[model samples]
Target: MSTFQTPQYTIVELLNKAQCGELQLPDFQRPYRWDDERIRSLLVTILRGHPMGVIMTLKTGGHNVRFKPRPITGIGHEGLKEPELLLLDGQQRTTSMVQALTGDGVVDTEDARHHKLRRRYFVDVVKALGDVREQEDAVVSLPDSGIVTGNIGRDVVLDVTTEEKQHAAGLMPATVLFDSARCFAWMMGYQQGAPERMAVTQQFLSTVAQSVQTYKVPAIELDKDISKDAVATVFEKVNTGGLRLDVFELLTATFAGDGAYFKETGEDFRLAEDWARTEEVLHKHPVLKEMRSTDFLMAVSVLITLSKRRTALAAGKTGKQVPQTSARREDILSMSLDDYRTWAPQLRDALPRVARHLRDLHIHESRGIPYSSQVVSLMIVTTLLGERAEEHAVRARLNQWFWCGVLGELYGSTITTQLAKDAEQLPDWSLAKSSTTPEAIIRASFAESRLGSLRSRQSAAYKGVYALIMAQQTPVKDWMLDQKLDFQSYDELQVDIHHVFPKKWCEDNAIEYWRRESIINKTPLAKKTNIRLRGDSPAVYIDRLDAKGLSAEQVDAQIATHAIDPAFLRAGDFDGYFQDRRRRLVDLIESAMGKSVVRDWNVDSESTDAPANFNEPAASTGGVSIGGEPTPDRTL
Candidate 1:
């Protein structure tokens, strides 16, 4: 069967349908955004009998496709009514025409600069009939007051605030264009007021005004039996608005169309409001603050699909008959409100537990998280594990899989397919339900050579190394204060990643840039301590720390906590410190990833030699600062 039909609708017919609550917009449609200039151009097109464009709509009352319907922007009706059609495209054009050609003719639009405006459109009777090229100039947009003023509102340049003034000036109100009775009465008043130009008024009425009154607009209407996904795909392709509609928006519309939900709640279920409340709850935990609405929906999808797969197995379905567990877009779009209700609260509780797990790994803030995308799989796996997630053995296995994803840099690209795999396998492996290792762990491999390129937080492994060092079994400590860097001090003292050997010292001593700025040379430090060590050598700073209060032994102990070789640091031996710290960082990564990093000690020799001056322009290398002072070739 044909899924759609191309039909023609007149401007008056569409406007009348809008006025009587027959034609409406789907809830997912963006609001009218046509500015004053565009509205004027549309009016000019109608007056000149030019085809504006085609509009696309969906027939309502389809069993398969249901979206909450809303009235056109300027339309007002006494009570809600079931709309026969829902506009999917050409919203801006339809809204502009309805406001300018019907009702009060005062369009609630914006200026070219996007400033709000309330305007009424009119056509000069004589000019509209003069030259086709001058049709645009004939269209006038005035303020809602129907007055144009000059000289700081002291002089009235033009006034059409009353019907008498409109008739005397021979200006035809666009509001009367679509209504025959109103158009006839206005013409009669204009002829009575200007008997000398009676012939001109009649000619204007017959030619110019008549063109606008009988404008035909092309419309393509989708059949009522089209699927929701088909409607979404067609709407995105035809919608002139630039923003692409997402699955959340489609589901929000579908959920609102649930007549049962409205009957019970006495109002439409607002998914946006529910998401805002979810954010309020999740924000209480810093590690979970980065969770997006789509991420939550994906987690719910994983849970629902997993249940479906298990149900299929229980029903003795085999092979292709069983549903594959999925968090894909198609699966998420098919989710019912009942599915969300079943799993949303469980996933919400599981997310905070995920945050605690991340805190245990010393990822104290959302910014420190290596891959925020991995959090979804973790939430689902943790929820499936239930109380067993707290057990040491289960957590150990979960931590291994997480670090494999991070240090392996697997979650940096498209991850939906891998996420589904982990959602299905990780919990089963953790519970000993299956002996097969999760694909994330099996695919995980880290090379020793990646350390040279791991200069910025932009790399997931760099962040993973930082977190591992801070989260070492023996707590790390700040250089000056000798305070233990736990969760409390991590936040209270305002810690951040900073260079160890100091960029100034490296440049002064002619160390290679790659080795100098590498993640192996950085560690988390208190903000005040970083300020104190600005552009100074480690040897210089260690003595200053000693002079402040701490003995040499205490300073060395604090330095050792960060996996640094204190003797190499105290001797100002860059080569020895870099090599020793590299091995130590690799060990920490291996312990977390549950795999050995391939050693390529000569990888640094394969790179270009450092420039003789070891100094480059700040822009060539990402510009950096120490205590907010710019230095050449410095990187954070």
Candidate 2:
């Protein structure tokens, strides 16, 4: 039962079908990923009358299921009924054509991912075909601000302040060539005064029109009876678009092939729709809002893996051993379209509950979560355990898991295996009321060497330290306002990573880059405070604050809350201050984790000696006592 029609379509006919709602994209196809370079290269090929590529479509209006037809380029229309064809492949080509011919952008209201294509595109006819024709010269997509005429030249320009004088220049809206009348009106608008130029321009445009009219795209039409799985296979075999289809995308196409749509609501099996809905759900919770669709999918995979294993164990199935980590990842990769469809609903319901559980453990927001792997295991554990998730024993083991995962950098690489191991242990561990403390699990890796070289923010250990800093509510507020540092209000507050010892000050004092740029030196403060603190040393800034009526009590509170040693506020003593503060910060981190996990107290300074001029003695060494010690005031 071969059910396919091979056809060749000119650009004109292809666009007309799109305009009449006869051509539609399947729900699972990813949104347009082509950048301006790819789009322009496509236009160059089309202008030269070259075969763009094959478009794959599925026929509709038979006994087979079908997706609701949609206009190719514009916003959605309620007027569209059923489409005669559902695009299985070639969405990128169709979308580019629609934008080039109709001047409408391919809107993306369904995918949560950011899109690069949004504005209408125009072609520079002169540049597209000059003495030296290059792909870059063919077409220019406009920015959000639209076209600017004055800046036009070799390539696309942004502003159009110089209007009619440049009209002698050949700039044509990509859509104008589609219709004779619109094309004529456009030519007349620019060709009014210069009749000779108009004739020349008209001839050039005419050639373009002919090129567009005659350009052929090969297409294969699948019969309505084609199975969704077969459609996925075909796309995998023949897809020419730059990004190869991942399994998620393949399953999406498979489901769309099934044409599972709600008859009353007109909703279809668009995986993007489900992904977008999951994003919406995550957005309602402060901690999960920043998660991507891939993250959500991974959480679902963990849930599926664990639930299956637990069920098998309970049923006394002796032969089915748990898959290895790489094999577990493969299991997720090979998940069937039907399985994805079945599990998506459960994922949507379970994810929020998981996020709530994370919040109880002081992972206040997305920034506080160290890795995506941690989110997967936790999401599954919380989902499977439900009300028992908050039980004393479950909480203790989960806490151990959290700190151990963070400190050990458990999810840094080959995360699937680690997640599988955690998932396998969680059901039993939660029920047993006992598990190894996070400190004990990662005890071998804990050392003074690890603490001395506090790595970049990307390191899990650094993020672990940061999580503790955040959990302790370090009294560094936004530079501009009185609001305490909070990740939940991040949108409204322009908080920035600030240096406790300003970088410029270190540079001015000839400090080495490593010591100046250490993670231990950075803290989160509002943007305004960072600017205000600019090049001042701690002593100068603290003095300025004191004069601004920063009470003695307030200064003491800031030092203790932020784990800053009194020596840090003094001038010079850079090595000693770093050492003192590093120990203090490590202690604070250990306190938050409820374990004596910090094994290092030495500062890993590249050079131990400070500049001779920088080591000035303090004017007054006595001040307010903080955390039971008298503060030292050094010379600025």
Candidate closest to the true structure, highest lDDT:
1
Candidate 1 clashes between residue pairs 3 or more apart in a chain or in different chains: none
State every prediction's TM-score relative to the real structure. Answer: 0.92, 0.59
lDDT of 1 by residue, 136-219 (tens): 688988899988999999999999989999987767888886677788778888888457778976887787667767779999
What 10-residue stretch in candidate 2 is worst by lDDT? Answer: 627-636
Model 1 misplaced stretches (Cα beyond 4 Å): 79-81, 130-133, 193-199, 263-267, 607-636
The lDDT for every candidate, in the order shown, is: 0.81, 0.61
Candidate 2: segments with Cα more than 4 A from true spot: 1-25, 30-253, 256-273, 320-346, 350-368, 391-393, 430-460, 473-496, 525-534, 547-554, 588-636
